[model samples]
Target: MADLPELPATITVDLDTPLKRGDDAIATLTFRRPTTVVLLDMSLIQLGLVDMDVMRDLLTRTSTVGLIGEEVDKIDGADMLQIARDVSDFFQIEEFEDLEIHIDGDIVTIPLVKPIVRGETTLDELRLRRPDSGSFRSLSLARIGQMETRSLAGLLPRISMSPLTEADTYAAEPGKQRGSLHAFLVASICTLARPGAIVDINVAPDRQQWWPGSPLIDLNPHGRTQNKKHRALVPVLPALDRWLRAEYATYIALSQQDRAGRGWLVNYHGRPIQDVDRAWDTMLTNLELPKGREWRSYLLRHSLATLARNRGATKWDLEGFMGHSDGSQTEVYAIGEFPSVVTALEGIVADMERLAPGAMHRSRTEHGLVGQLSKGDENVS
Candidate 1:
């Protein structure tokens, strides 16, 4: 085993398998300190860093020159494992040396940065403010169990002096506070998809499973792309449609190789975005969320499902829209497009708009997104 590198360290590794980026065949990767939360969503530290998926995720988050999932996948197996081992060494070598946790009754505080306070009464910390049972005034048992957004949104404004206003307590802060692309990603997940399903979407005019003309997105479950039979038609509500148009226009303009390449809809320099952990973390930071309140993009899926159900969408409707029924017999024997899916999605979008006015607005025009209208496509309204 090699010695662990020092804090804020750098290490370069020659890749056994080079990646193709335009005319360049990149053959090396230099990793740097993972500047953000290394594993915010990982609850069981006991699982360790040996897992390939976890290591791949960490590598993407920490890479100095930046790497997309596709690029990371091309890394040699031996090299990848060694990189993971190096990461484990760098992060876990000195376990208790620089660790700190403070608990005060219901509040648990963790300060990532030093507080610069010139005056009196300055405490540098981020703490959780737990709400007592009294916080659930008019909220019913059923609504709470269902995780209804509207009810929870209504309740959150009362919990803090500074209530979260984006989607009540559900979403991050307003789109204006963060870049429009960030807001677009958040809103897209909350309204139309599981994060991976949308993030991996390919929008090349000829290659995509569906197009702007289609009201439904034929989402291939992220890791199961090889299984062609398994796909779900997720509804594109009005708000989601606007976002798709904007993103599509931007994607085309940037990747003039429109007829070639994978055509990943959400990309960095035309490369597919395989994971969004870093983006999610960045959004949370912009929101100034308390340290302990880290959120995953998957939660937006939950919010959409619960919000739709609360607004009277049937289980089948949600199942169809969310790809929950993908591998089941429903996909083969009796899988017809469900009108209720559209209705349910529309309800969720309406609720989002009503709860936080203009929360779903397209703010990415400056990024060259055209938000184009369809040319009388039968599938789109």
Candidate 2:
């Protein structure tokens, strides 16, 4: 963290060449290190243009290079050495020797000296000192213009799937009311008699029927809706029935207070029974959710479409079930516009009946006779 040393006002350049009176020789001297500024001072004896006092003053003034002085002050010793090496490489100079540096706090002192052999100077050693200047380079206009026409090519289609698992259907301490609701919805869809048929549900009607005066009915009258027109075309496995019923039971039990309190799951003081976000967080912490809502919705729709396709359902039939508008663009332009809960539940029931003839009947019988009566136990500590 030490500050960089400052450059001296001038520098002395030693050359192997001797100069005649009034004869000007430009010596191109290379630096042993990287510096922002380079100073070159002519020897008084060689130039024969000034006295020793002037020459001594010039040498003292040229002792430090100003260009890299600031940078050196800010950087550590290791970085300074590295920068020096880099600068040396840029100059492409070999056999540079007799490098000496003196530092007194922030001030740098450099003394330039050359060997004298029999009072004769070698001309080959004479050179002007030039510091390598680094500056920012801007891109040309032509390159920027060319970039405008560049287009992305060959985008890969992304597909995703999210199947409801046993853990979702039967969590020991159900996380959120929404989670239970979602579980119930998925379960109900699975229980439909038609394995490959589209199931639709309207949240409004279903909520009204399930809990007539609940505040939730007013909040979201539409029952759980589905994209029936977009067929997933996947086969409805038999295991879906049990899963759906379990989810349904859990959802009903959790929302039972809301049902009794005229459709609002909140307490009399209007405080929420549980935080929805916290519930969702719990689910996220325990389960792997689809990346985003669009992806999840697509996965659900795709599953239905795939199932329908496998069941010998025509494109039009699939589209109708999915509530898509009729046209050539049905596959691309058309998406589920109206998701009806009643229609969906009916379809699900029918499918369930087809898959397991006695399952729905037994569930109704058990739920009506015993399930409803024991529901109170759920809210007990």
Candidate 3:
């Protein structure tokens, strides 16, 4: 057996500003463990070095025997694990014989045996394998179960709701020329739901006509493609349909004067029209759904993709519907090619229209709003 590297006497700790309470500061500590170094490097890459600085400070300050409580509030579990691996690596330790982590509310106590590293390859294997037996495995299993339950719970509400009413369906129709634009938006989102494909939208041109007076949706404000400024819409077709229809009705009701001053739709005097974000929020809130922002975005795209998948659409078909490039690489490697993507979208839209014909109806009937007061007390006076 190869001898292990010597353990460092003290480890470096870092703390964030928010955790800088007088006596109790939250800190993260990283030691010289090989496994830890590997994990920390990955985390640093993911979070960026700038973000890791505060964490590094907190860890260094808390490593002392008596100062752990004084220098830290609550150690981050992920950070601590990464630090432990780093410490193991630095000391050339291998095979974590006995390591125990106990969590009680905000407090966590980790007791680990010193590792003895053999060679680089052996050390790599040790880091990848399970640290010990029993408790860790059981705890991990329990955590997985809890996460699965939470995910299932999040999906339940949306699945159980009944289809929208006919009157509501008809209220979403844009004029003849704009109908295709709405379809394109819905189709693009459906395309994204497939396994792997990049989607981009050119909103500037559309925004000019669709939102004349509104601020331009800038694509390159920071000169970085990865920045949030260039985020493209890949809305789930069903959700987009639901959202767009609602917005159209709300906008039309509030905007009274149509293109030719033809009072075609019933006007709501004083009711605030639904903006994009507000419309999405209202729909999710009404359904009492709980999903993180990113997951919600994925769900929106997934909803459309799922529809396309169900219709037996070719992947290439779906891609075309989404306005994606139909290059050879895309045809061979992309999950949702044009054919499949388009069919799924068309099928979903047709199903939704069939089930909820009123979804496209924008006209407000007297029966739809019996006692609801008009905006600005217009009906009251």
Q: What is the C-alpha RMSD of each candidate to the true structure, in Å?
A: 21.1, 26.2, 20.3
Q: For candidate 1, lDDT tens digit of each residue in 1-381? A: 122233446777777677677798878777875532454433224226366776677678778778878878877788787677766664563534453656655444555333424222233444433444434555664664544444555444333222123323333344434433454354454445666566656665555555666766656633445353334665566666665666566555554445366446565555665666665565456555533332455665665565455445667767766666665665667655666556655544454454455656655443333423354322221
lDDT of 2 by residue, 1-381 (tens): 122233322223433442222364423222342221221222213223333333233323332432233322433445334333433242332333444445433223343233212212221121111111110012223432332111100000101111222223323233333433343334334422221221221122244422221211111124334443333222232334333233234344444455333322211222223323344345544554433553232244454455334333455555544445223455356433223322333343444343334433312223542354335333311
- The candidate maximizing lDDT is 1
Please tell me which model should have the higher TM-score, number 2 or number 3: 3
RMSD in Å for candidate 2, one decimal? 26.2
lDDT of 3 by residue, 1-381 (tens): 334344565565453332444675545433432233223322332222333444344344434433344343345555554554454344342444444455433223333344324322111111111112211322343433443333323222222112222112322554422232232234334335221122222112222211212222221113334332223223234334333333333334443343222211112232222222333344445443443564343345555544344345555454444434333454346433244444445444444444445443322323222222122111211
Model 1 misplaced stretches (Cα beyond 4 Å): 1-192, 221-231, 251-259, 290-294, 336-341, 366-373, 376-381
| lDDT of candidate 3 at residue 213, scale 0 to 100 | 23
Q: Rate the local accuracy (lDDT) of all candidates.
A: 0.54, 0.31, 0.34
Worst 10 residues of 2 by lDDT: 151-160
Compare candidates 1 and 2 on TM-score and give the better one. Answer: 1
Error of 3 at 303 (Å): 2.3
Candidate 2 residue runs with Cα over 4 Å from true position: 1-162, 166-285, 288-299, 325-381
